[model samples]
Target: MIALVTAALAPGIALLSYFYLRNEYESRTFTQVLRAFIIGALLVFPIMVLQYALEAESIFEAEWLHAFVGVAGLEEFFKWFLLYFAIYRFVLFQSRYDGIIYGVALSLGFASAENVMYLMALGIDSAIGRAFLPVSSHALFGVVMGYYMGCAKKSDPNNFKLWISLSLVVPIILHGVYDLILLTIHENVMFIIVPFMFFLWWFALSRTKKANEKMA
Candidate 1:
């Protein structure tokens, strides 16, 4: 069990550390980051309850609604809320890069808990797939979300709305499309999944660089 949890959590922590180290302008204290991460982890329960309620009512029967509205949209919104309410408004959030840092911290927190549950249910063999796909995907989604929020943070008054809107919308789209593809998985679809993941990584790294530039 210990090993199982370690396998489940390692990737998320690694990703969290990577993002944390990128904060060149202002270093956030460990306590601040830990608060965000713990809050994010706690959010998974409520999100799961809401998702279960939606599923119980047959809300997830429709593929598009399930993937887009139910899963991706709902999950991302809660994470965004955590950042907006809990972390975004904090005084430590002085630069655009700080958004990405906190955003990834929250996301990895969510991913870590989710991964543990999945690995426990599915057994250790599933760890490799979960680590690469769901865990890393959440990190990527967080990057996209944070990048826009970072833009919103640094935006002139007039541009705040646009960047804030993108902060939510872009992640929902990427996550929705990602879940939508997996929902329809078949033998030949591996081709699409690989390229899509590659694209997500590329987009995430590019945005990461841009966000880091703000610190410079």
Candidate 2:
């Protein structure tokens, strides 16, 4: 029973909290933000799960190429799609906060799916550690991307392309580094990743805060 609670509740809380923290913007009504978030999250979930499953099952070990590009590229592509379509295309988002809110929402969806899968595979212990770090880190990355999207949205027409391009490329590089660190966990080097991930998240959050301040 306790195990069941951990499986369900931990992922649920993590998903909720990650997005909630990113919802610091006053632009989106709760419902508008929630709507875009749910739609975008649902859109990305299956693609992420399938990619993880295929990579995990591949006979070729988790090689450098696969870990670096396949892992980062696939996830980054979907999130970029969410930014492109849900946040950018939809005239629905007027305020910059909407971008961050929706970005975090999509990330939470991916993370929630990931957490549930990890828990089911390794049981409660893995889920507990992931409950904070991996989950929150993904959301923070989304917040950064969302902040840039807002800036891009407000920028000159030609410059918008450059900002959008950077927004996608930058997150993928950061996420790729994160995957690199995890691949070495069997080497007992998990501790090295904690500080770096902390630093990365802090940097991302600062950018997000700056974006919000600019909007205000």
Candidate 3:
């Protein structure tokens, strides 16, 4: 039982820890971050219901369409909504880096819950694979979303629209590609997930630096 719990939680916690350390502002309280994470985990229930409904309706028959529009689109949009509505207007969101903090908190929350479900159903081997892929993939998506959200917050009123759009759109694109590659899962295409993950890590780290610079 302990091992299962650890398998369920470790990936998300590790990713969240890394991002928490990256947060220079440290303006948000632990309670606030916990609230964001709880909100995100709570949201998974509804999202899963929707995804199951879609699968029941055979909406996932077209793999690319399902991976991109259905799965990635639905997941990212809701995650975006959770961040935008739950924390975007909060007073503590003063620094540009706050978005990344909140974004990772929420995204990791979702990932943790999702990871538990997969681990329970598919066993530890699946959990091991997910730790390296799905959990971190969601974290990368969070970084992309948060970076734009930070920009949106700091941008001129005229540019707010563009940054806000990117906050939602970029994650959807990255998530879509990530899911598509995994869904395809061919011997030939298997090599692609590696380079893609590397790029995601590099991109997320660069975004963190940029957000830190904005804070400075």
Candidate 4:
């Protein structure tokens, strides 16, 4: 009973955390955030399905390859493209914070789906750890990516591709490093990685503040 409850709630908590962090954006309304969340999830679903299908084919059978292609590669690719092509190009993403908003929304979408899968596999009790670590890290990576996008937009139109590439690279590197760390299955790298993530989160928050200040 306890395990089942944990499994179900873990995904909920992960989503809640994404929203909570995203609320750092002062200009965005709750309704807008919800809408972005929905759009992001819908956009990312196809990629998740692809990851599932590809993994099933044994092409992603290698443990290291699984982390690269199955986990980090597919997921980051989808989220990055969603924010870049779907929201950035179509929406009124004029300000830097808008980039953060879209980026985090993309992360939440990815996180929500991934959490549901883990909760089903490991159940609720084991979810406490995931909620604390992997869940938050995913969203934070999006923030980093989003920050770069905002900088690109504000800087020079010609440099947009460079910025976009960075936006994707930052998340992929963070995600790939974390996934590889966990795949080791025997190290206390979590201690190192957790603090490292905190640094990244802090840096992202500071950049958002800078953007807000610039907008002001």
Q: Which segments of candidate 1 are over 4 A away from where they belong?
A: none
- Worst 10-residue lDDT window, candidate 1: 89-98
lDDT of 3 by residue, 73-142 (tens): 9999999998998898774666778888888989999999998888888888788789888899998899
Candidate models: Cα lDDT each: 0.87, 0.68, 0.87, 0.70
Query: In terms of TM-score, how similar is model 2 to the real structure?
Result: 0.81
Listed per candidate, the RMSD to the true structure in angstroms reads 1.5, 3.2, 1.5, 3.5
- Minimum summed lDDT over a 10-residue window in model 4 is located at 16-25
Per-prediction TM-score to the true structure, in the order listed = 0.95, 0.81, 0.95, 0.78
> After superposing candidate 4, which stretches have Cα over 4 Å from the reference?
1-26, 43-45, 60-64
Put down candidate 4 lDDT per residue, 58-106, tens digits, no spaces: 8876777877768887778877776777667666655676677767766
Model 1 accuracy (lDDT, Cα): 0.87
Q: lDDT tens string, model 2, 1-216?
A: 457446634654555555456555556566655665566456555776677687777833665666557777778778888777765787565656556666777766666666665667777767657766777777777777776787688656688888788778877888878887777566656677878878877887677666656543
Local distance difference test, candidate 3: 0.87
Error of 3 at 137 (Å): 0.4
- lDDT for 9 (candidate 4): 44
